[model samples]
Target: MRFVLAPSVLALSALGLAASPALAAQEFYVGEPVMKEGLQIVPNYLTGIQMSAHVPGMEMGKDAIHLEADVHAGKDEAHSLAEDTWIPYLTIKYQITKKGSPLYHKSGVLAAMVAKDGLHYANGVRMDGPGTYRLTYVISPPKLYRHVDKASGVPDWWKPIKAAWTFQYPSKSK
Candidate 1:
């Protein structure tokens, strides 16, 4: 009446157990990824933190939520950027509003950051509590000057792009 697991299975089980803590540390609610102007934008959120210690120029506060944006190059062959590459040096601004409210609950520019998940823009915001809310992101092109040869230059960056999503706070998984 005894069961035995294969060596490979045991190894996989040990690896999963070892990685669970890092994977379960943060539970996030992710919005649908939007594609526009040759770029893909994804919005997500998790519990907030006192990030001043880690990020330069970030204020210290116990914000309600840590919002993030993942911007990547779209699958467009015309552009020089490789598909799914993280696009850096761009300005991203976020605004949050309750679904039924006319006024914005919070709004600010997100700082570029690197985390376990990779490069993205993120910021903290204090929420009024759990509810349905609308999140909007306005992305501006990278401002760095690039020296390009006429034959090798890529197409110009897209104009300011806006993407929005509505998500419920205190998501079911969280």
Candidate 2:
């Protein structure tokens, strides 16, 4: 029997570890459409460098898609922090405005991908060499959203919280 673990399921299974906010910095994209959905496989911060586009200033939109290859982790401990000690991670970022999904709150998932473990899940497929992985994802509430600030109660740019995948690299250490 085959089962697909949806992104929400995967997020709950890992107890939010795979997509832990503590594991990564929250990415906010401005000028994103009120509603957006798509797949993106971005380079983990550990890959010897940060993708220029991922930098804070780069403009992202609802239709933006990126496919990154040549994956190799950096040695710096801080940069590797994003992997959450997990390597071969594919970082997928998406944003949604509050107008997209009604009743949208932080109680649900943001983004996720599935491995052999199941749909919208974590871990690797035990494959060798750099392989292309299809990142199937889902943004809950089916709409756009944004986070309100604590100090000022000011909601920043409309965005769906970022979700990351740390596909354990083929390492015996892990």
lDDT by residue (tens digit), candidate 1, 1-174: 112345665677778753323222254766888988888898887553434345443433433667789889889934577998998899998888987666647788998877666888887777766789888899999886654678876666668999988888867764
Q: TM-scores, in order shown?
A: 0.75, 0.17
lDDT (tens digit, per residue) of candidate 2 on 39-116? 222332111111322433332332222212112223332232232233223343332223233443222112233223
Residue pairs that clash (backbone atoms under 3 angstroms), model 1: none
Looking at model 2, report the run of 10 residues with the lowest lDDT sum.
Answer: 26-35
The candidate that wins on lDDT is 1
Q: What is the C-alpha lDDT of each candidate?
A: 0.72, 0.28
Candidate 2: residue 61 lDDT (0-100) = 32
TM-score of candidate 2 to 2 decimals = 0.17
Name the regions of candidate 2 deviating beyond 4 angstroms: 1-122, 127-132, 139-151, 156-174
